[model samples]
Target: MKKRNTCLICLQGLSGSGKTTVANFLASTLNIPVYHSDVERKKLFGLSPTENSSLANLDIYTKEATIRTFQKLYELAFEELSAQQSVLVDAAFLRHHERLRMQQLARDTGALFLIVKCQAGQQIMIDRIRTRQHLGNDPSEASEDLIHKQKQWQEALTSDELQTCIKVFTEEKNWQETLLQRIYRYIS
Candidate 1:
């Protein structure tokens, strides 16, 4: 008997927006694999002790390398989907073009594309980052300066894309519960 193809849920957000946390929860609940870009990159390329390694230095490559990396990831993801496996992609897809490309990937692969945008108050985001840093579990490795830079970029986000994507305002309150419910509703 042929099994049905599973959905592909892409969690897009800024740094420290709980993309990884939410993706982890959703994958665990749905029994799907979470494909984290940073994790996969580290596993594939091995890690470096230098703060600015080759891959991190590639951040200044006009986004061409980043686009290519995502393209390859989509191809790999589609192969898994073809085998009837669900995948949760956790990445900071800050650009509108990246989101559109993922949408196209979903359309081409016949997989459901759920664009989830996780957000939070500035203070809460800063607190989360600090907590993670203190615990030595910060995936973003974003410092205060980096967060400021990210805020500058996010402030430039167009209104149209903000409206289209799912906005999850997670504060110090029941942020996890709200995010879980949103994911459940989208996937179910």
Candidate 2:
């Protein structure tokens, strides 16, 4: 059998920064599986992706829950990588250690690792959160308050990480195409 090429794309940003959007778009365009923290976290409690997790009487946003969620995401990615498939992971990787975990996973699997740092203005993030809440169509349960808190918690990518990173302005009109082109260029 021919050796298959695979990549682990980590999409990280603040709440409502549109990292999920980028992840979904990339997954569809590239025909790859994508693991999403928001969706998986809710699933852990037997909840639907768009269901109101707030009403589940369980705090899925707790640190322990987050750790478990990221672990699950990594495991899911590992399965795909073991099968020689590329995968995308979507989450707000606020801590440096969270980002490192994914990087290490990529190394362990011998897959090319890339980070897509989705970004938007604070106001834009807040607005997006509000709109998403009103629609209740997204798996994310982030609020406007979370946006402010996330701004304080998010760590900038280190110089070394930037070597394999792409800064995506999700606020831009043609961001999907731009990001796709950049990824194609990088992987080529």
Candidate 3:
């Protein structure tokens, strides 16, 4: 069996590092569903995906709002995993502690926890973000400025986290297959 009944795939990366694209790919390939942080963040403020929302907007991305979004994201992922469904969380989880929280949730639920740190070159990220924005109706409400902000404050994954982490350099051609094999090793 190459599939676990329940596994939490948490994607941690900076904005425009290709988290969303990879999340969608993983979910589609592995028959899982994704709970996107950006989309959920917008929902927290009663705004739709295409609507304007930003970290600058305290009402939408306030400290309290961020906490609530994470809480709700965890809630949704927990519920889905509890029901024996694998879940993929699409988020730029810049904080190590929040990633640990998700790990703990998996432990509490007896599900496999895997943190996939997605990475790409700076130019690649900027290009991707620009393209996504140009496409219109992007689910992420984050500004391109977030790309810079995330780079400044990101708590990069540590050696301790490497045990359960699969590092995927999204710019690499074999990255997707590499991650799938790594994940199948745990789930299967």
Q: TM-score of every model? A: 0.75, 0.95, 0.90
Using lDDT as the yardstick, the better of models 1 and 2 is 2
lDDT of each structure?
0.65, 0.88, 0.84
Which is the better candidate, 2 or 3, if ranked by lDDT? 2
Compose the digit string of candidate 2's lDDT tens values, residues 57-103: 77888989998999999899999998889899998887889889889
Q: Which candidate is the best by TM-score?
A: 2
lDDT of 3: 0.84
1-188, model 3: which lDDT tens digit per residue? 24445789999898878888899999899878899998898887787877766533546777788898899899999998788788999887888888989999999988888888889998888888888788867887555798888789888787777898888899998888898888788888
CA shift at 86, candidate 2, in angstroms?
Answer: 0.4
The TM-score, computed over Cα atoms with residue i paired to residue i, of candidate 2 is 0.95
User: What is the overall TM-score of model 1 with all chains considered together?
Assistant: 0.75
Show the lowest summed lDDT stretch of 10 residues, model 3.
52-61
Please give the lDDT score for candidate 1. 0.65
Candidate numbers sorted by TM-score from highest down: 2, 3, 1
- Is 1 or 2 the stronger prediction by TM-score? 2
